[model samples]
Target: MARLAMAMQQEKKHQHVEAPDGGWGWVVVVSLFISSALVFGLLRSLGVFFVEFVRYFGESAQAVSWITSIGVAVQQLLSPLGTAACSAYGSRRVVMIGGFLSALGFILASQATTLTHLYLTMGLISGSGWALVFTPTIASVMQYFNKRRSLAMGLGFTGVGLSSFAFSPLFQFLVQLYGWRGALLILGGLSLNIIVSGALIRPLGPTKVIERTKAKSLSDKYRSFFSHTCEYFELSLLLHRGFLTYSLAVTFINAGYFIPYVHLVAHSRLVGFNEFQAAFVISSTGVTDIVGRVVSGWASDLRHMRSLHLLTIWSALVGLFLLLLPLCSTQGNYVGLQLVSMAYGFCAGALTPLVFSVVPEIVGKERMVGALGLLQLIESFGGLLGAPLSGWLRDLSGSYILSFVVAGGFLIMGSIIITTLPHFCSCTNPPPLSPKDTKNEFTEEERLKQVLSLDSTENIHNTDRIPETLLSQNHITLEEIPLSAKRTDDDADC
Candidate 1:
């Protein structure tokens, strides 16, 4: 009791409450928003320049696409490595360095005269930079909040939507005015915003102490590295119930998520809409995505909702929207497009943070960084495969009807898989018990009585019936003790 009291005192003395808002935390959010805008938001607009790049390079669409695809692939593949670096060093330095590299990659790509040069500069280097910037930004935010985490994440992710709205027109204007080379140069300069943002992400409160405590001996570090690396490369997620369900669900949902973005403009043209109308359809998604992210986060916090349930419900709605999209092919169908865009955007936006939030829930915060990295790697494969497959299906058939149908089918399947999660219905509830039914079967009071009984019979301590005042003074609760003197053992027998 004395030792426990001492420990509690020490913890209280060392612990600090981070400013729930304002201070360095807000600075980190701003920095992350900028970085996110550069990476994810910029990536969202890549299709805007895809055709131009294909023509300029005199390459097939498939070949030119490899540039963007490889960049995405590298970003996804190196996510765990980036997470490991953040865990070892700090988020601030990692993000700063990543920003520099990313900007440098774009600048170099602007000078590239060959496809190979573009691949090396834009794909590999820029991709790595993005991975570094993104992973740490997420980690830094997670470190800042516990109760308001979902809201914080929502605000941070809103950058993507905001950036899409701002950057798409900007990029198109720049490409038209200055050509691809000059546009790359301008965008490269813009990437420096990431560095400035990264610099602002200082550690908050006791997070520094926690990071220091995580440092291990050399051999222990090596063992930990090997274990994590194995986990990263392994397909063992298929064997883990929670991971399997998450991965499969996400795969299905993502198949639908990107297809709309990829084909929206083309579909608009097909339906006899002007280029601006098509762009408007894509941009509308961003507006709704921003709204969805913020609203969903706030709602999740208020409702104390499980992330999976929210994800499943939203994804199911998105599936329904996709099914309805192809039905409206006329000028009147623009309303349908708007509705589908908003619904899809809402579902995808909400699902992003909710998915990451669940990582900490499943494996605990200690392993969360690693888990997120692995999950990104898997999901990236889905992103890479889904869009092109949809495009190919469109080409093989005369229309996008079958393509969208397949995409909607995948979304529904994903939603169903997500709904099957054990804790989807009850975020606060413990998992189901096994045949023994002993792990989580007892009430707190019952457990306390059992402990008190055990202690009384063994006479483990010199003191008996320690008063509530003593327990309170020592920061111990009555629940910690089991009394043996109780007549009925029914509570303890389980």
Candidate 2:
């Protein structure tokens, strides 16, 4: 029994060291597809239900807006907690719990009699479940693939676009047939798919926990706990300069990124469009969004293109499309509206894949979970207020024009801010990968050859250029390992 246990442990360690870029990764991607399909896809299509709530509950647009706003805000705000749970217990366990809570939230919401009831069930309960599922699924998908990270993320997130396309119309049909209450009940049952998604997420093997010791003092135990906490939650990222800069830009971007999803359908109604026409607007965006995400995923993977650069371009384009929205609503005809919606959807979707990919390039993959959680926690403020503020503007001014323009302005500001990052200092230069980028695509034999071969030894320093005075973690110098010493080591391996 002892030998069997030891062998199992060794096998797990070996699998953990070897990147399984495909095999189970495709299963993980399918799980991500379903999770994304239900989570944000439903959220984006919630605009179809927005007007129903206003009329049923006798609330103003701004007051009713909190229904989705609170849900989105809660999801983002609690992401760190959810991520911490996933890190402590595998992703599958955390997400399964989330799936149950999510279904319960919808079940409770189906019986809601007041706006407050909706807030508790639909907002807090459902949002908490989303927080658990989202970060874990996304972070897990990234861990499975190194070479095709961008493409995997693109495919996983495209679920949002595909689901959004079908959901908007289907939600409208369901609401028409069964009313919002019955719709909620049916939606609750549909949300059970999250459990299957969660179950599909196999454990990534046990995380390396530090061994406890009887010899350690209480103070030592406390210090060790703090260290593990920092590693698990990546709290140290708060102090990282690169993280701070990128986060600041995303903060600005989030302030407006969700405005269209929440308000565009309502905006169409206000501008004299019928129910079908309004829903079609969202559907159109969903259609183009699919194309944008897939194409940009491939684009970001280009040998010469940087993810951050692609992000900048996409952000700028999204802003441009938002700025054109008011024109589409007022002076522009149906053709103009379609064109602008297509452009906006494509650009917005294009930006999604690059956002997460750029993080691994800036920080190492090991810190990805924490970095994503912290970013979500910080950006929750924007998600909390973005739609409500848009609703408030409409309440005050009786139009969405100024609101959309301001949203576009926020994105434009974000696009400009990201350019000031260390990599963007020069338009022609790609920002060098961080010193800790341990992503090596080389097979075991190739790695052995590189480590042992005496030819082109300088290439061991992977980054563009580094001075001898500043030796990075991955860098090896002649003074440290003379050729004579390397030859002796190589001969032993042979």
Candidate 3:
């Protein structure tokens, strides 16, 4: 395993191409944009329908909440499988199938009258579709860009915010006008955009080249497949020092990340704000999220510091703001929340790209698809449990204060873990070169010239050109070469 990793690293060092930004790449970006917007936007807007679903079904808040939560959990947990399918069959196929599933799920959901049906159609099918769509999209993006990868990924993920902003109100309007069934049907129809977007994404690189290099013989292919499968299940990442640290830190960070977003509206109401004011706080957070993503992308590219370090610092600051959140329960508190929200949004925006970026650096580009899949699979557990756990704390304590405090504590722990990463301080240093003695050795031409001189048993000395201090210090003797041999020596030097 170590040998394979080393070989993969060496291959990556020499083989990477600086990504081209225009043409088909732009087409893929546009496709990804539409796809991301549709998938994430639809997911985010579930809260809009949450209350209606609860009242209509006569279910408890926790029961109806499972509809969206289960869907999200399914999407996240299935990421590795979806990614593997993409690797085996092709991203194009996976995405197309995913789109179909998403549309079908939503349509099936429209006919549902019971929780079981909703779970099958919305939670299982739609969630699986999301897993298929999201995993492949990220893998494809990595294949497309190198230098501009973070920026591109940031831009692409902004589709989530775009969709949330545009669709939330539209979905609300649809629910008001056409009942939940009609609204779901409309959403199902709109979900076809995934299929169209999937169609737009042709395979990005030399698929033949990848296949040829990775699997030469049938036996080799079988072995490779088995090995990959094993790696996936074992999560070799747990053994990697940097990856383990990052994973643990991120788990803690994520444990707190969603709390503010989840409770922003309720928190606003608690402070005596009207519904419109509460709604505006959510809207403002989304708007700021857009701005934050863009700015963070630019900063990540332009700044000299390591992106992970920047992300860690920002995350810590965001956590600190969360710690201060409980103190603001008045009108002054609402204003404070908005400021913190914007700051947190900006930091969180930057943190997303950084989160995925480190995987490629830690593992190699070759293994990136698998690594990212596994990473998300693990982190999804954090996402799945974070908010509800916070809510549980709220239930236990009769206040959101302790929950926020716990969230802050987790974020701080995450920051500390991130600070311990080896690469955090090594970004300024170039990679260590091999043939260690080469650091102080003469040039190849000079070495060759010296070796050539040994054949004639003559030392070619140019005391005039050589530094006098070095010759004196070494107390070396110089021998003169014949004029005929000097020309030969010059030719050899050339």
By TM-score, the best candidate is: 2
TM agreement with the true structure for every prediction: 0.76, 0.82, 0.76
lDDT digits (tens) for residues 1-494 of candidate 2: 34323433343333333346788988998898899888988889989889999989889889888888898888889988888887667789888888888888999999999999999999999999999998888888887777788888899989999987898888899999999999999889989889999999875555323111211221122233344455456665665667778887887788788888888988888888888888988899999998999999888777467788889989988988999998877853666877898899999999988888787666555467777888888888878888899899989999888789888988889889888787675545444443233233112213433343423333424332222111211223235432201111000000
Predicted structure with the largest lDDT when compared to the true one: 2
The per-model lDDT (C-alpha) reads 0.66, 0.75, 0.64
Regions more than 4 Å wrong, model 1 = 1-23, 58-60, 112-119, 205-240, 398-401, 427-494
**Candidate 1 residue-wise lDDT at 6:** 46
Question: Least lDDT summed over 10 consecutive residues: which range in candidate 1?
Answer: 485-494
Candidate 1 residue-wise lDDT, 277-358, digit = tens: 7677768888888888888788777756676677678788778777878776555578877777777777767777776766
Which lDDT value does model 3 have at 172?
Answer: 62
* Pairs in steric clash, model 2: none
Off by over 4 Å in 3: 1-18, 114-116, 206-225, 231-235, 266-276, 325-337, 397-401, 427-494
Give the backbone clash total of model 3.
0
- Model 2 misplaced stretches (Cα beyond 4 Å): 1-16, 208-225, 426-494
CA RMSD (A), model 3: 13.9
